[model samples]
Target: MGNNLWKDTWLMTVRNIKTTLRNPFSFIPNLIISAFFLLVYEGGLSGISQLPTFEGANYLAFILPVSIVSAAIGGAGGAGQSIVKDIENGFFSRLLLTPASRLAIVLGPIIAGMLQLVVQTLLIIGIAFLLGLEVVTGFGGILFVLLIAVGWGLAFAGYSAGVALRTGNAQAAQAGTFIFFPLIFLSTTFVPYDLIEAQWLKIAATINPTTYIFESMRTALIDGWVFWDLMQGVFAILIVCTITITFAAVSAKKAVSRG
Candidate 1:
């Protein structure tokens, strides 16, 4: 059963990747959007380097993780959209009759999203290097940040896939992804947590999972490994992932029943 599960998941993951490559239009726009954010911050927000949050560090470096995080979550949007497409076309129904592992059906697309997130992260980092942002953690740090970013993408993808399974509607999946943006935006995204003076905003940021993820990424990129600090973010990820995967599992089972 274990071998079958792994094989099924791997094959489904490969299928999702192939489908994505064949239709680049599905998710390429997400990378473009992330690039736009990175560029805007690089040019327009350079002045924020003086803010207490950054404390004289290059603004681009401080916000690079923000842009990467944006891209990571965008991958989930892509996953959700794909699931909707599958559901709309009766593809999911066919899969339900197959001998494939049930969880694999849901997880395969998410693993693809993780791959997308990791690749996007590397490209963004390369762009940063080109634009004169120094990577303080080097190759090891690059790998570390990639793992962290991909974990985030997988976690968020669970929520996205959950919504897609529940609604089976493209628009709902897209809207749900939009809802994810504000939570991260409200957090200490633009500045450090200590610099946030607004009490309500600070509290929201404190509670947001991405805040810890962003802080951990920043630390990995600029401050070194710091396992203890990174674990907080990991814990947040586990919580979010657990909740969403559970939701997705339930929704998927419901979908099977309805079909």
Candidate 2:
């Protein structure tokens, strides 16, 4: 309700961005880890796409979404860790003393993490491009892919920020963020859900929301501008954000009360 509420959040986000840029090495690992998995999987699992289920599919295109998802997770996890550091170092306490919106403190990391993901997303996609993955949707599609990456990153950042405020524990926040990886794998990370032969894995993938996120990204990369996939991805992000950010915002409020 404050007139300058957004200004505070933007300044907070800028502060976090400067902190991240000061230590450039922190940003490098996310790109490296994503590229490593992309290359390693392309080398080892290229043949998997030859199966009847794949039926003329491109494996690199198939896994590009996976790589981007990994990149998003890494960036989101880093955001949470940085928030924990601030909380530990008493900077968060300093913020609590200001009339700045509590929402600003909670949202600053989400905005910074999303902005950081823009760079990481481009890195993952650039590597994919160098390795011979072509975007069927061309320039517009490329931008759309970036949007999907941001959505997922925003969702993850919300969850991470919530965990950081809830526990104020670095280890717990890291573990909480890492737990989302299992959901990624359980969804269609390595193979198509219909192509998966394992009954249990198939069932889990069927139920997992990330499967739709991957499907949306994959559809954008290969199938051009399909309205359904884009809509599905947006809705999935809404579900995740509604749960994570809502919880995170509430958790942040509670943390302030406790502080």
Best candidate according to TM-score:
2
Residue 233 of candidate 1: its Cα lDDT?
72
lDDT of 1 by residue, 86-179 (tens): 8999998898878788878877887887787787777888888788877677788777777878878887887888899899998888789877
- TM for candidate 2 is 0.93
C-alpha lDDT of candidate 2 relative to the true structure: 0.85
Kindly list the per-residue Cα lDDT of model 2 for residues 1-259, writing each as its tens digit.
Answer: 4436789899889998999888788778777989998999998998998988876778998998888988887787667877888898999999888888877877787788888898898988998989998888888888888888888888888888899988998888878976766767998888887778789998898788788889999888877788987788889999998998898888888988954
- Candidate 2 — worst ten consecutive residues by lDDT sum? 1-10
The C-alpha TM-scores of every prediction are 0.91, 0.93
CA lDDT of each candidate?
0.81, 0.85
Q: Would you list the clashing residue pairs of candidate 1?
A: none
| RMSD of each candidate relative to the true structure | 2.3, 2.0
